[model samples]
Target: MSNRAKLFGALSLGACLLWFRAAAEVPPETVGQVAELPPMAGAHWLWVPDRLFRHSILFDGDSGRMLGAIDSGVQITPKPPLWSHARKEIYNVDTIYSRGHRGERKDFVVIYDSRTLNVKGEVEVPPRAADTGTGIALVGLLDGDRFLVVLNQSPGTSVSVIDLENRRHVGEAQTAGCAGVFPAGPTRFGMLCGDGTALTVHLTENGELDRLARSKPFFDVIDDPVTEKGVRDGSTWWFASFEGLLYEVDFSGNAPAPKEPWPLFTENEIESGWRIGGAQHLAYHRKTKRLYSIVHEGGPGSHKDPGTEIWVYDVPSRNKIDTFSAPNLIAPFLGPQAGFDATGMLGSFLSFVLPNMGVHSLTVTQDERPLLFVRHSDLGAVGVLDALSGEHLRDIDEAGLSGALLVVP
Candidate 1:
């Protein structure tokens, strides 16, 4: 192998070793009992993360009806901070979203209630969460209880597991450079690292990081025709579908190289399709293994009109299935207090479609209802989409966004 390749390999090994040492020293936190929210017999809640301000938690009535917005009193100030992954406990706090400001995290996590929509509690992220120069942190819950947060650290990135049961910071794993994180199985997770590599890591005894198969980037060529025209920002802005591209690796750790790379979507030639002028919300379907993204029709900032498009891809087959468009989308006009007029004024704005860019966040209901959450480039409006049938649900007014999605078991 070339000298550079050998050096890169050594660096990855050293980083992993340092992380393992840290994990061993950090004992698990004592998870306090989860407080339950007051009974809301027929209400369901979803989270919205804004870029400029605080995250917003919204409530929907039974059968997917629009109930109204939940007041998450926390306001994440500053112009370019992040409030990511809003989630609620089963019946207690309405939701919690991850927040960090100016690259420094003020709170590891924040919580909210369902009935009154008030701030409930806060938790500290594992020591690994405060890494600097990392962009686009993704958080997830594993086996229904444990919390996992992954992000790229300057010069590298790592994954940390929070012992929610004990309510304390716990295990962590240094990973390949990453931009996104996904649950591959019960104890296994997948990440597309920042260095253009995709890897799957399995949790061993005590949350140790086990080497899994990795994949090299197959579609690495930049489409100059589009990018040169000032299109395609390339900032974690692409989506994958059920059969778009699947790279299966043998991560048993018994093979020659535990950190090898492969591609899962090689059989079909998957290409970028429609573009939502200023779109930025993404959703994935587990059963169908399909990926969908939402884009706004107009330019960023102003919400004159917003549109929706659903791109279906099969990950295993690496193919594009179909596309649908919804010209009408609802825009929410938000106010400062609980007495704000949020009724009847739900769906107001419209969005256009932009191709290739992945979504910021997305989710599908049990009944196959695909809900995509998107923000206007420059406005404080949010868009919800029904991807399966291309139905524009409603748009709610929110500010300073990062990521948004629904809570699923």
Candidate 2:
């Protein structure tokens, strides 16, 4: 070969290698980009978290647009963000782990500015009992959002009271054997006990535990237990039992006065296997005084199953006013296969063999035109429905948003 041809060939090979190296070295963008979002009027925030990334995302319920996010640091599991109406601050409770020691961990209530989403302050919460991860109400605001209550489960169950105004952890209240924190009154909260009673804790002006009391055993805990995720409106709380019974408890006074347990489903409906289900199955529209529950056709041990229908009830009359069918409950099974796609056929077959895919949680937006945000865990989708008309608006599917606890501010 000629010397010129050999030199040309060598140069070409070198250039090709350089180009390939440059292409390979190009970097991918970060998994989650932290961008400031413009404020939307009447917007509600959704607690969509990528558990793998240890960050909780706040999404706009109206447009399914991501408003902002908070980094919970490495190996941290953050509770749902609590919005303070009076203080205009967002509070998040997270279990932060130490960098060097895997066992070393600390709990912190991180506060953020409502408008800017900036970290305002962080108060360290002492370690207490952990919970079952059933998406229970772990954090609550009392005294017109001036104080914060966090449920702890370090084997020994108790609640940590945080003085948000003072930005300090005041004290802890012994909940006896009860779990979960439920706002009962202006300066009081309640916890569901294992023995079917609710232990109510009252707070003083300084956010200290003033006293504690327990209600009479209202529901059967073992055979048919009430869910911890009850819907509260004013001083009344609607708790649903495993067998589809609604126990209304009025906390207007010192003790939790229980009303008669009303059957959520009639005898005929029960015969057809209609039951209340889901982690966060029930939601209440306070302004409209409507109660919404996710229901499905399942037998005794199917409380965790996704719901096929949403039953709306008038809170005052305790009568069913409307029902909305949830078609997305099985839409994931069909996939992209129209009729004869092999993969789609396989998906459908597997779906039938597997458990039902339905709504896992429900929340009503605090907007003028309130929309119901339904979270489907198995499909990793959120469906928006008209609160009054029960019209399915749209579905938002994003990866890593599964099993997210919904919060409306």
Candidate 3:
């Protein structure tokens, strides 16, 4: 063959080979569309609110995929969204400035369609709502989701009532020294006061204040205060004190009924310095009646310290069952199997190193097969574990740092 023909043939072959190589290396087509990750992901969705970012990010708990987020707003304390499966909507009370950080202030409650994740409607509220963060207790629903209760604070504590069915502000109730709005019954809600007592505010069907009832002082407000984090089972709200004591208060009656208080740990565990600690420490599963808490070995003034492990308790039996690890920075260095042993030599070394490596907030999904979702606040990462086994299954790295954990299910 001629030299020119041979050269042309070689060049053509090289071009074809390059094209095939490029085709093999190319990634799959990117789809810009949004689709649900798993079947009924909303049932097990994890809603994490980052107060610094002024928003809440939603994740498919089954697959740990980032679904979306809600822009809550800035300069105001974080307001966790209220999730209603029956209504197929998530309600968020937000106070947004006209500018990114400052300008005109507008306070309103927004309803988002859970399926479409879009704003359905909103109701303008008075500008006096509280700017202090209160986790999930800041917002509440009553009367089978007919009325919405929003706590207010401009130095004094009060609550603004909103008629959800009519989408209008109804009235305001003076709660005085009480902080959160805990729905007591069909019309009223309970609040923990500065004096360590509970005040139940009853409302008429039209959302008007009918009367007020108070409970006898049950906890010591100064010594061992009950954290604001409370989980309700039926008409009873379970609270844990800083010293690891449990309070079971029945709000079903006309007034709050405090049950016999008990300590979560035995004398030995107490001696080991085991106490509940974390931004959020209690996560209760209604079916199993199991309350999971973040526990750590620390002295006084460490109530807000990160937890080294999780301890599970059965509410009815009032007995400890399972315990799991939530190790800190050095735990990974000792290998994957090494847990945070607060009493051991390595654990003592970790205390001197980065003692803050542990779970910060936790929430458990209510389902036949339950899963515990824990957040490491300092790192803003999430750990998923089997509720029954306390086995660490996986971690969701995309969750934003420094936020409270909320599960829609």
- Tens-digit lDDT track of model 2 for 282-336: 9998888888999988899888876868999997888999998764533332232
Order of quality (TM-score): 3, 2, 1
Model 1: runs farther than 4 Å from truth?
A: 1-44, 61-107, 110-123, 126-137, 210-213, 216-281, 288-290, 295-308, 313-322, 327-362, 368-377, 384-386, 393-409
Candidate 1 lDDT over residue span 84-137, tens digit each = 223444211112334422343333544444444455555655433322111122
lDDT of 1 at 304: 19
- Candidates in order, TM-scores: namely 0.54, 0.82, 0.83
Model 2: lowest-lDDT 10 consecutive positions: 333-342
Residues 1-409, model 3: lDDT tens digits:
3323533453353354445542224468888987533334455678887767778888877777788888886634357777765577778888877886678778899998877778999999877677654365777887588889998888888899988889899988988999887786779788899999987888899998998888999999999999888888877898889998999888887788888789998999899998888777888999999999998888887888768799988889899888888644332223212322333675456436543467768888888788888875545557778888888776665466456545554
RMSD of 3: 13.3
Measured over all alpha carbons after superposition, the RMSD of each candidate to the real structure, in angstroms, is 16.3, 11.9, 13.3
> Highest TM-score: which candidate?
3
**What residue runs in model 2 are displaced by over 4 Å at the alpha carbon?**
1-44, 50-52, 73-77, 99-101, 327-356
